[model samples]
Target: MLEASLKTQMQSYMERISQPIEITANLDSGAKSQELRELLQEIAAMSDRITLVEGSDDAQRKPSFTIARTGTDISVTFAGIPMGHEFTSLVLALLQVGGHPIKLDEAVIEQIRNLDGDYNFETYFSLSCQNCPDVVQALNVMSIINPRIRHVAIDGALYQSEVDERQIMSVPTIYLNGEKFGQGRSSVEEILAQLDSGAGARKAEALNAKEPFDVLIVGGGPAGAAAAVYAARKGIRTGVVAERFGGQVLDTMAIENFISVKETEGPRFAAALEEHVKAYDVDIMNVQRATKLVTGGNLVEVQLESGATLKGKTVILATGARWREINVPGEQEYRNAGVAYCPHCDGPLFKGKRVAVIGGGNSGVEAAIDLAGVVAHVTLIEFGDELRADAVLQRKLRSLPNVDIIVSAQTTEIHGDGKKVNGLSYTDRKSGESRKVELEGVFIQIGLVPNTEWLKDTVSLTRYGEIEVDAKGQTSIPGVFAAGDVTTVPYKQIIIACGDGAKAALGAFDHLIRSSVDMPAEAETATA
Candidate 1:
């Protein structure tokens, strides 16, 4: 059932249709189809300028819908039920069909027009992904403006088999003609470049074919950027390799705790970080993943996925930690649809809605406490018999009236209505009975895995696989420094990582001074 408040919100977003917008729904009476059909009908009912036509469903054809201007055959299609995060996509399609101009740069439009052959962009996204909407909108607009371009936004949770076949491990993954075009957040300009250059096949790009850097940072997060800036200040040739420039900050939403700045968002903060680092001559290689690391030589070697090697007199590792996934059914597909990972990134999107947090650890409890203030209600589920969080955290979570804690519970499956998560099923350990909770979203905060697998062979790692580092951020290997969540840091926070990065950069400089400096004058004269 749709709430009146939600209906009002939808109505406000529904711009008035000028030209006649025709929606032909070729749907069966199945549950998913009927649900989508009803929602579409409701949307059409809001605008008298819109027309809906119900066509007989054919077994060979999927439950699809086409939105087109009344007179033209140029149109877009939704092959399946558009729900969850994709609901917005459908609305945008309707608006575009109703004569809304495609707002894109002229250069970008030229690039799109230049793309030869049929370019089918199938972007898999979860409703909860903060960056997904932008990517989806870009593809949708491209499809509307260019006849050669056709885009489809697929709900990964709804099609598990397809996700498996395609090897989609993450959300906001774009497939260009069945090949992975890009993963994570991508700009329209970046996407255009990838399309124009045929970079969908994961082509290897060369990095640092010439002189070796005095210092090379392996990540692009706050830690790595800090190191780069510090190293560059010393007037040494510095380089940086990053899978993405933002790192974990991209997934983080609010920044109230970041000292000095009263408030800021993730993307903005990341851009600032980049700006600060770029002030110096830092050779930044964005979107490059490190596959291996070799130490002990005069120059350390960092191998990338592209087969290009980066050499450095000193190497600083700052690859941040990644969230651990539950790997439960519906978890992958419904990502952003109702299954979310970062509370800070996706919590505000679900304001005044009910949600659940899986895992009884400190992270889970913390997420529940954080979301309780923004969401209508919170349900915290744990597989253990009791919460593993500190007593203070437990107290804080208990102090919240809208939060519910469920221990000794095993999260069985994530259930959704083909689009967004409607609820989830959990089995009570004591009773051996299955139970279900109705909610709009599920947040996963089990733990984190350090991004140091490539450095394991080259550096001394702790039992947990984190890069072992000293107080000054020096690693076990000389001329090698490490920082951030990937190292043996006491706490993983933005400020702490920044401080750690600064320390590591200083330590690398110190190593250069101590190990490479000319011997004292007396010793040099004695040797001569």
Candidate 2:
């Protein structure tokens, strides 16, 4: 009798389980399961949660959960298996459902809330990147701050189809709506400005107002910023646009070798430089992109992807370079938290934290030596048998007290908690042994790739894609100029880029003065 009663209870429980839950999945089949859809509708009618329709391949299957969006409370689950970096996506999905907005300034929030039109943001990133997380977080915060702003994350690994369609070969490529904005990490202020400008452009279109600025500079790196400052100083109406104002400098670990200053950081150096530029009369289009450029007889016309257009006498290309990624698991998961590329930018953030430097090149050895002074422990992992840097630097690195060099060791995985990095796993090629090291951060010092793709249609690029410029930083084209790492300037150091930028600015001034003297009477009359 007891067995029969137990069987009856089990049967009742099974029946209850068989009944559909409140969650509904909108699959590709163009058919929504009526029962599950009705359940979700019932849940949405309540003030408990917001209804989120997540995209999935299977349309016939019911959604895994009925997400509840009551104030800050929300939950989500994937119908398909979540593995590798997809796990990170799962966590983000939950965060989105929970309505937990990442910390953002109230002023920024207010600015975004005032936006009336649609603002679409699409960002591309690789799964093996460490710095990409900060950028993704910044975009996510922007989306939460304003409903008009929609943030879409494209996985460079899984979305090869979309990548090819969009011509995205690099990580962290941002597109505002359907137009390409910029690439790499961006700040909150920069992104907000871009959205605001887009909103303004749409409003102007509705009212048939004239566009702003005469010339638009696409990058805000040292070279780009210097160009803007110089252009403004020359009394030429100019505007500077960049996805982020600092460019690669913000990702640098240190600036000890930069001229004049004994020591500095990526962010500090960028901040001071940015402030100087901001002091000028120029219109600072921070966190924006010049998507298309059309050269006419007298004026160079530029179309910003934000639906804005500007006319200029000439265009200056100063987009900088980006660091190459060390493809490995867990690197992307704990990037700014523990895994970092620019030691100068994030090294101090890891003060007394255990850190590892990857690669055996000059930058890697140099980073290891520098980090040894600030971090508790420094582990240098090299995939090569011998260090490829200068002998003096190698000797100096070897003599460091807290630095350990492990040759023929390749990083396999980054191990960490969901919130922060903890350690790393590597394999020794020479000994055929797997090893693990406890570390707080990993700095990738492989190399850099120049920002020269946009100039491909305008100037001559080397096989490596760096622009070919003369001694005066003048490109093959007469009015257009190239500077910094984007050019074949032999050296890729900060001082070199600064010197190049200064020379380019002077070159631009010379060109502008010459043009002012040799212009058509009508053009001169207009200026007068």
Question: Whole-model lDDT for model 2 versus the true structure?
Answer: 0.64
Model 1: per-residue lDDT, tens digit, 225-285? 8888887877777898898887888776567788898987676688799899999888887
- Looking at candidate 1, the ten consecutive residues that score lowest on lDDT are 519-528
Q: List the residue pairs that clash in candidate 2.
A: 27-59, 49-68, 49-69, 50-69, 124-172, 214-311, 253-343, 253-344, 253-345, 254-344
Give per-candidate clash totals.
6, 10
Please give the lDDT score for candidate 1. Answer: 0.79
lDDT per residue as tens, model 2, 1-528:
124554454334323221122233443332334433543343333322334354465543333332333442222333322222333443454355454444555756777678778867776665444444456656665565565566656555444556557745345667887998876566777566565755555533532243444444667888877777766665666777676787887766468887679997566688787889878876666545666666635666656656766665666677888877777888787665567776643454455768899989988988888778777989998888888989999999888888888988888999987867789999999888999999878888888888766555757889989988898777776666677888899878777776777677667556656774343333233321
Q: TM-score for every candidate vs. truth?
A: 0.63, 0.54
Which stretches of model 1 miss by more than 4 angstroms?
1-114, 117-129, 133-184, 187-205, 327-339, 343-355, 361-363, 366-378, 383-403, 410-441, 516-528
Least accurate 10 contiguous residues by lDDT in model 2: 13-22
Q: Which stretches of candidate 2 lie over 4 Å from their true place?
A: 1-188, 191-215, 257-259, 292-298, 301-305, 327-338, 344-355, 370-377, 388-396, 399-402, 408-441, 509-528
